[model samples]
Target: MKKIQFNLTFFLVVTAAACSNRYQTNNHTAANKADTVQSKYINQPLVSHIYTADPSAHVFNNRIYIYPSHDTATGAPGNEQGDHFDMMDYHVFSMDGVGSKVTDHGVALSLKDIPWAGRQLWAPDAAYANGKYYLYFPAKNKQDIFQIGVAVSDKPEGPFKAAAEPIKNSFSMDPAVFADDDGSHYMYFGGISGGQLQRWDNNVYHADATNKYGEELAVLPRMARLGKDMLSFAEPVKEIKIVDKNGNLFKAKDNDKRFFEAAWVHKYKGRYYFSYSTGDTHNICYAIGDNPYGPFTYQGIILHPVEGWTNHHSIVQFKNKWYLFYHDVQLSGHTHLRNIKVTELTYNADGTIVPIKAMK
Candidate 1:
């Protein structure tokens, strides 16, 4: 009787193992199918069928293209550490003009395709050069350190191919690339706290580093000119200095005006406009400078806070009208899950941007 019972127990265990394997395989197949499903929309909040945030809008071949981070329902609890934003893939959106239909080019890139990225594919920006479209993104490497990576595609909306590794000397998150009229391309990147900018104080990584408080010079974003190939940095990274109208560096206590993250550059009337988010304060602010690498003078806010805890954006001119592409949490009602939106940006004759109210 003991021998018969032992054999029956072994058979049951084998059956259970087989069933679990089958279940995992089926779930994997479903996820792959979902990744390729495409949707179209035209109204505000951009694409509603799926959650997207941190819009990086650009004009490619006269059409407006947006590269945004794909926000998923990761179920991780929200916190200052940003563990809740566990995005693993990206989607590209495009439209001919303001009221035209926007198409979702599904799954442009994913973590599985990236050799070095471990997780959290955050805000991304794109540039067109060298006869191809380059997508710049931030992801934590396998060692759990944040680094910027680049991918390329033949077309603007892409199923892009990532480089084998992250950019040399790249660190932190939110990478925005600006292609100057002179044919020079520069990348603006970095963020504080959870975005990991604090860790790289003085350009050296310190695991215990924290942002300075009141009166200490505010944390600055880093910029590097893209090499002629557009894949590497041409020079060592430099910190961008943003001063007040009186030419004084902002104190760390000036939360409303200091740079937190989301570096974007746009040229207007031959002057460089450097804009960024005031992280915890939740405002989109800008500064003006004579050149791309600045001593930018803080002007004022471009956008007031939206419903979410974070705000990120990009400014671009499509068909001669400038628009701001940004995101808020109106759709999911959750901070980590957000929807992208675009509104007309007005500039005064003096080049100061008229602050616009965010639409719910």
Candidate 2:
């Protein structure tokens, strides 16, 4: 009887050990499933809580920060003039890394806070200089013209305070601030069609003027060095001329390769790369030049047409890898409403960028 009881006891002990081992294996599998959730959104919207577009990404203080335009649905009728875009505020977003949680720093700046701004607070970019963070944006003034403005904050993500007035001699839309390695800062801006680039002739707006669309050279984007104060232009805005491999300027009719809006600059291997969205065509193209003020030779498309009417983007390197931040209408399926996303960008050995197909 003693031998039989020992065998029963040993059997029970073995069963219990097996059950405990099985439980741990199942728990480990469950944890992996949670990680799969993170992997699934690799090319999806970085944030769904609020509509964001025109991502201007930067790596500040070892973290990735995105300053994007806050798109709102005001029920205004959509038109070629962009009357439907009624964005009134700016919200900044940040992430630790890819596949990490994104934090939406709500209401960094707003329309009401800008005393000189009338409406349509469009795309914006941020820069860190002079021990402060500068937010550069474009908005219509009381005169019903788009003028670039500057706001300042001590923190990268902040409730930035707008200046009392727009930057002196600043006009048109899309202000992209590029901080060079030599501690110099330059601002690139301008857009065609509804962006009103066509209305400006010689830095002066002619309300009755129209774009030179046929055989004429494309409407050029403008660049100006920011003053030491980081508030106004230090010199007159100069035109950025993009040319073909044969050294011929892209005519206005060459919509496929012309610059439309959303100018972004980044340095790689000591070469200045100027990239911008080809509006209407919905492609992001890039150029390479020895200097920031380019007659940058036209390279090729960085991104193909996304699932929307517009494509705006920014590129930055973080932790030894380059990534492209762009927006599309995938979430809402509305042109005015958009969601920002990021994907890894790779460069060829010849110093040209490999084109990426935009996320569906």
Best by TM-score: 2
Q: Estimate the overall C-alpha local distance difference test score of candidate 2.
A: 0.92
Q: Which ten residues in a row have the lowest lDDT in candidate 1?
A: 34-43
lDDT measured at residue 270 in model 2 versus the true structure, 0 to 100: 95
Given candidate 1, what's the lDDT at residue 144? 85
By TM-score, how accurate is candidate 1?
A: 0.87
Q: Compared with the true structure, what per-residue lDDT tens digits does model 2 show for residues 107-179?
A: 9999999999999999999999999999999999998899999999999998899999999989888899999
Model 2 residue 106 lDDT score: 87
TM-scores of the candidates are: 0.87, 0.88
Clash-forming residue pairs, model 2: none
Q: For residue 103, give model 1's deviation from the true position in Å.
A: 0.3
